[model samples]
Target: MGTIEYTGNHHAFRDKLRRYLDEAVAPHGEAWEQAGIVPLSAWKEMGEKGYLCTWVPQAYGGRGLDFLYSVIIMEEMAHIGESGFMVSLHSDVVVPYLFTYGSEEIRNQFLPGCVSGDIVAAVAMTEPDAGSDLASMVSTFREEEDCFVLEGSKTFISNGINCGVVIVAARDSLEEEPYNAISLFVVEAGTPGFEKGGKLQKMGLRSQDTAELFFNNCRIPKANLLGQRGSGFIMLMEKLQQERLVCAVSALAGAETLVEQTTKKARECIYGSGMPLIKAQEVRFALVEMTAHLKMARAFVNDLVNQHAAGANVVVETSMAKFLTTDFLNDFSRRSMDLLGEAALDDDDVFAKALRDGRVMPIFAGTNEIMKEIAARFMGL
Candidate 1:
């Protein structure tokens, strides 16, 4: 049961995806990253191949696959050297909110598009000053007869520009208590007063399509409220386990790729004495240590994924996984750069890009600091 098997059906899936990525996804990475956005066509191509929302139910025009498919996609995407598209953020992170909490009508209306990639989804929760402390958000929404007029701004929204729909978290009232006031809504793109702001260029994940979103007296029907009013905080909390798990998964894959790549490069390079870098005793020791760490992380993350599949709550454990894996990723990237020597100057390239991109793992999906805080609480510290 501990085996991370890519055999049989999984093997077929991986092979098919490799062909697709080589044809469509891989070739576009440099152009998309350079342009600061991935085109809609790439996402549409993924959807056509049933790779966008694999877990969605068949009744909603999806393949109704299990979570194993998601794990494969996350790892393979990293393996294929494409990170900025943020497909997991769509299929796993954002769309689940709709699948879990969206009303029947809402699900029927949007799930098909989501599965088909016509409706890219983004979650709008973080604001200019509000990030991890979601309870302290200043954006508020109020009932306006048959509609709710939302007024707020959200930044660092991935897929902001390409999203056809966004699941926005807003306080129902101008109250300081987030628990009692927060609610989620399905706000379609181009809704009146819902304006898409300029894209915010970032150091990495440049093709992420991140943008600032503004809601100025934005009006949406009451039917758009997800689940129950005032349950937004709870909804977000419920999803944190998966979200953090996703971060951990991606971090593990990134670090794996980095170690695998750097080790090969080290083996190929020779000093004046003609000794490959891998020949050094300390270098050998370091590689062995990293191998051990990655092995443990793989086992731990796989166990948690299995737990998640079995419907077991793994909030604290996933938090530990998230921070530990991401923290290791950051350290691994920096040290790999050290081992590679002058090769570190190859910016705008994979090795350099890996370092730049790896820098973000500690910051996203609630920073590593926040991850530790959650773990401490669960630990009774």
Candidate 2:
């Protein structure tokens, strides 16, 4: 072989995304955090630049770019430290429902704006008493000839304050099976009976606005119904793999950033102390082990993304990636904090916030325990 080379597009994608991050995301981050929501103007600007929903079809004002583009977007955002803003969730997790299940009228009404960020979208499924087990959800919707009266409350909704439109899932009736009885509806903001409650403060991800939503007899035309009347459960299950994969990608990106930042911190400490933290055999070995683990985790997630892009379903692999990476990130992040000693506890430092932020990785996007359960099923256990 005259020449054997490895030239991947990830680097080019990263460079393009770096420009977008510096130009669009980085400078405005603190302002968005202070506001507890990203400005609609920012979303519209992203849409205008074809960054909001790159995978959407051109007819809908999207580029119909490859999923790799979306992954690059996710990686760049995480690399620059804005996971809380959740652009991937909006583009990958939430909008797919409209693209896949909505009627032409619904698509015609929403897709263009979603592509342009004129309308911010969120999924309303998690309730106060129900999260992983959606069967226990108490939200109900009653059909009235021309519309449905939605009455329920959703808690812990991402983009709760900023969303101009939300896809809400509610039980059809008391007698129906909770899973099968569920249905999705499009609820616009400022509806008469729909109201947003106070923001729920969290341990981290402070920039992400999470809130409670109250729907009391919120009436919307049957035209707002998404997909078949009884298909919400199936749709949610089908979409969960992509959501889990998005989480997996974000987790890996966050892990990579954490490791890179911590390594720099170690070097800086060495420069100051006359011996780097790596001089300590214990710290040295810890870094070695962490580097190996992270490499394997990233490789696995990359393979899973490829498999998904190639039309293979990645439910099992995505769950494994989510479980392994998030759990590892949680522990590894704390260990890095310990290595940094007093500096780790300082709020002004990135390490302190990384340690705090990484704690939530294992909890959200389905807990690590649930991820393991999903993995166990694949093994016939």
Candidate 3:
């Protein structure tokens, strides 16, 4: 039995999107990984085919589809072993800010371009000194006569190089009420004084364009502020449920893919005298263990997604899921790589790439330590 009860249309959509990726996206994974970027053309093709921002309203040039479509697309992205596109990050992570909190003017200005793929978006939250802990952030945004001046820098931003617009969280005041002073602002790329640093080399997800973002006395209209003043932290807290859920789903998908490929290879690989790798008791045990573990993870993630889509508050649960799934995938990928022997270092080693990419799952969307703290606090233990 499967976790998600995908409808026929959902299956059809998945098949169509999978075909598109096979042709237009998957072929260039190695090249993009080497180049440290996925081109804008891939994003444009996604938008044109209705594979991007499926949850956005139709008025904003989207298909006005449900969240499941976005989920399908993300799972397929993992299946193809290409994380650079980051459609889920743009579709579910950043665009929701505009769709939910932006003023009519801001929405009308940005959401259309976002859906059309004319403008790629990113959210800048992590800084050189501060990550997971939002209150410690020192980036400041001061109100001037006609606009707000942003000053400080963000590090380790996904989609940093490719982003046309970024949602920047900055300290609204330097003194007094530091936590309450944080606010989010939409800073378009190339805004004077707002600069994207050179792409940062990462262990994996090389094509995802992670980099540093600098704001040197940048200025933008007050209208760019997302939601009310001093509400950025609250807004971020609300959206984290979805963000972490995305991490859990993608981690599970990646884990499943790696396990599937490794097992298939083991079944056919000959050691001596036509002895299959899978015929070894130890090898067979590992494969069965992975399958067993992932089955439970999938069921838990699927249930959480159902609750989340229904607007139920599952913050603690999703946090647990994020922590567990990420930890599991990291371990699973490492073990799978060792099991694959020297073949794991081949140029086309998908398992090796999965291991590298899985390393960041726990760190991003809040660390596993943070997730444990959140879940523990809720449990009153």
Candidate 4:
């Protein structure tokens, strides 16, 4: 019901994805919600079918396809409004960091399993006091005789409870600048001192397992370092282009869904009055305006993705896309709910979920404020 679900960009690919969602994911969504996490089998099922990282190279167990396949995955996620799921983030956002920047040995050790769903991964960057401001982060790492000691905690991490492997950002004690001093390390699930706190109950994305991750005297091999020392900040900046683009796509998709669902609810409400919302001038005008805005954002995101595959730095475009789309989604959510009146307040209905989910759209990936800063800088303001 969200924005035209498929733009006919890749017909055959879209069809395959539609089939997978109907056959595999949709049926288990509600159960996953109740369980607080998705079964690992779902990841394995997606990987086995070449859906986990459709754009990953064959050397890493993927189909070696175009980025469009990755877009297909994000698009499908929107169709089901599965914001609680981390598949798009795992497949496109985090995995590409390894594929693009991890040492060959590290890639060899993890990428295949990642592509095949044998391992689920997460990246920890936000600390309790340093959200959106990496400069304030205090997580520290020190070199030992043969390993590194990591001591820090990260909050509001996605997939925190279920990640089998985590990339942790730790500040290097030897460096003078906190943000520049940061480094990334790979930590496996059962590392002695690495533990997950309870799932964080949020206003939205409650099923997504956001949680606090603790690393107290946690030690991993020097070989676990993701890139050069003092490079984690640079690394985060480099990879966030894709991350923000994925966010933008997800936002647009979700907004479109909200509009669709709300339109239906409006129709249902107007039954006695006898006019579909589309038939009312005011409602029709709002729909047309929002549709145009979403369509423009969608087209911009598609082009950004294409540029990203061509190795262009899309940081500015990504910021714009994420900020604008998320804001629009939030507005659309409110307007749609308002249009639905009391019906939207139903606990059992899609409108309730849409309202809740859309609220978080502007907050994650970096708040809309941060996005505006990035966008402003890009505009030479």
Which sequence of candidate numbers ranks them by TM-score, best first?
3, 1, 2, 4
Tens digits of per-residue lDDT for model 2, 53-160: 789898877888888888888888888877677788889999999999988888888888988988889999989899888789899999888889999899999989
> In model 4, what are the clashing residue pairs, if there are any?
2-256, 2-257, 3-256
Regions of candidate 2 where Cα sits further than 4 Å from its true position: 1-13, 270-273
Query: Per model, how many backbone clashes are there?
Result: 0, 1, 0, 3
Model 4 has a clash total of 3
What Cα-based lDDT does every candidate model obtain? 0.89, 0.82, 0.90, 0.82
Candidate 1 segments exceeding 4 Å error:
4-7, 174-176
Best by lDDT: 3
Best by TM-score: 3
**Which ranges in model 4 have alpha carbons more than 4 Å from their true place?**
1-9, 274-278
Give the Å shift of residue 361 in candidate 4.
Answer: 2.2
Per-residue CA lDDT of model 3 for 1-381, tens digit only, reads 236778999999999989989998999999999999999988887788888788888788788887888889889999998977799999999999998999999988998889888889999999999999999898998998999999999999999988999999998765568778989999998899999999999888888999999999899998999999889999999999999999999988889988999998888778766888888888889999999999998989999888888899999999999999999889998888778787677756787888888899999899999999999899998
How far in Å is the alpha carbon of 98 misplaced in model 4?
1.7
By lDDT, the better pick of 1 and 2 is: 1
Model 1: colliding residue pairs: none
For candidate 1, the per-residue lDDT at 331 reads 88
Candidate 4, which ten residues in sequence have the lowest lDDT sum? 1-10
Ranking the candidates on lDDT from highest down gives 3, 1, 2, 4
* lDDT string, candidate 1, 185-262, tens digits: 999999999999888888888778889999999999999999998989999999989999998998898889888987
